[model samples]
Target: MALLGLDSALGATLDPVGVVLALVAGVFWAGYVLTSARVGQLVPGAGGLAMTLVVATLVVAPLGAPRAIGAFGDSALLGLALVVALLSSVAPYTLELSARHRLPAPVFSILLSLEPAFAALFGWILLNQDSGVLRNLAIVLVIIASAGVTLTGARRKAPAMSVEAAGTRRDDA
Candidate 1:
């Protein structure tokens, strides 16, 4: 945030609603990591993911169904939407489910936080979207920090010193 010139919000006013929504999103994300991991463990293969997505679609459809129904009238648009859905939403979730099955929950969740950094990197490389130097530095810092944390979490407690190293040498120097 400091790198984004957020160190000083000279004229900024807090939006309570936005703050609440962001907090809510964070809580939901935490829940998602845990729930997804459990689901992955319980259901082998993509069966769990498929069932979860189906339920999610049913829950979400009411909100978008009307607009979605209209979108079907244009065959090309419908095709485009399907492509977009598969590429952006479904594929990532599938990969996440697969990852959740394999990785430790905390490591998996921490790595997921790198999504924005990777997205920005892709944008810079592929779309010619240059995040300014400070923002770029921030992204690099975040990646480094995430990696450090993940590795640190995986570390065991300090090992007991070998007797030769911890004890005095028997011979004179």
Candidate 2:
């Protein structure tokens, strides 16, 4: 709340439009995380991600394409845009989905919860931005909570696998 400056006040937000929009975005982000796991499972390699990017582009292009098209006429601007997209969006999403595929959902979510810490850290280090005590405390709290969840929240026995499913006969081994 302190950062974007209040999805919630000390008691209430009074339903400000920015807070409402942010809440909606939060809900959509949660859905994206959940669906990204399923997409990783159903599609091999980056195919699912590729399809997602294409669909997202088609959906948003109507809003952005007219403005973006002019940039394409400049080789330097187009190259910078591609670089920014690849570094900021594509690579992170790819790695996030790859981790989501391997980790249990709870663990993945907890790990993702450290996003604020990472963002703050980057801002501090790369941009020389000062994060005040609240942000520092938040980073510490998030790390501790993530550690606790990893240690306790995701416990389970591995499911038994048949040898054929494991891709080897006992005799062959």
Candidate 3:
């Protein structure tokens, strides 16, 4: 929808290369989520966040380097970019990975649907982007829906733990 909106409002057309890049991004991100979830299970105590940053840095550098590196000298500019990276990359990655631990992959994808709402809200308050009562309400609706689905799923999974407990033999047995 956002892409459609951009196409309609801005007359922006994606070339074949752009379309391919977008598709590649979607595929890699899906893999990243699944791989993070698997690693999260193995490490037991480690956050999937560090892996996200590591992968992101490596991926972006090769594609974005000359221009991205050129802007790095000024402290103020560097700080701004770092702040954006943390907010856009770090927080969302952590939230997604943490949610993945308890939620099914489909449910995790649902929670991710609310991220645009957050981006919109931030843009409105910080950048004075256009926002109105309807937009705010839409954001609220997405958040509530995501939370309801996540919590309900968590509750359902909780009951399954009893089955595992029942399987454990007592020392007296």
* Top candidate, metric TM-score: 2
Indicate the worst ten consecutive residues by lDDT in candidate 2. 2-11
Candidate 1: C-alpha RMSD to true structure equals 6.4
* Model 3 stretches astray by more than 4 angstroms: 1-14, 102-107, 116-173
The Cα RMSD of model 3 versus the native structure comes to: 6.5
Output the lDDT of residue 64, model 1.
94
Between prediction 2 and prediction 3, the one with superior lDDT is 2
For candidate 1, write residues 1-173 as lDDT tens digits.
Answer: 45644422433655778768978997988887788778877889999888988888899999999889988899999999999989987899988877877887567757876887888889989999877677777777777787777777656445656788766554434
Clashing pairs in 2: none
Q: Which candidate order results from sorting by lDDT in descending order? A: 2, 1, 3
Where model 2 places Cα greater than 4 Å from the true spot, the runs are 1-15, 102-107, 156-173
User: Model 2 over residues 1-173: C-alpha lDDT tens digits?
Assistant: 44334323533565678778989998989898778768887899889999999988889889998798899799999999999999988999889878877887777777888888889889999999877766577677767877786766455445667868677655567
Ranking by TM-score: 2, 1, 3
Better-scoring candidate (TM-score), 1 or 2 = 2
- 84 in model 3: Cα distance from truth in Å? 1.2
Point to the candidate with the largest lDDT. 2
TM-score for every candidate vs. truth? 0.71, 0.73, 0.54
Return the clash pairs for model 3, or none. none
lDDT of 2: 0.79
Question: What total of clashing residue pairs does each candidate reach?
Answer: 0, 0, 0
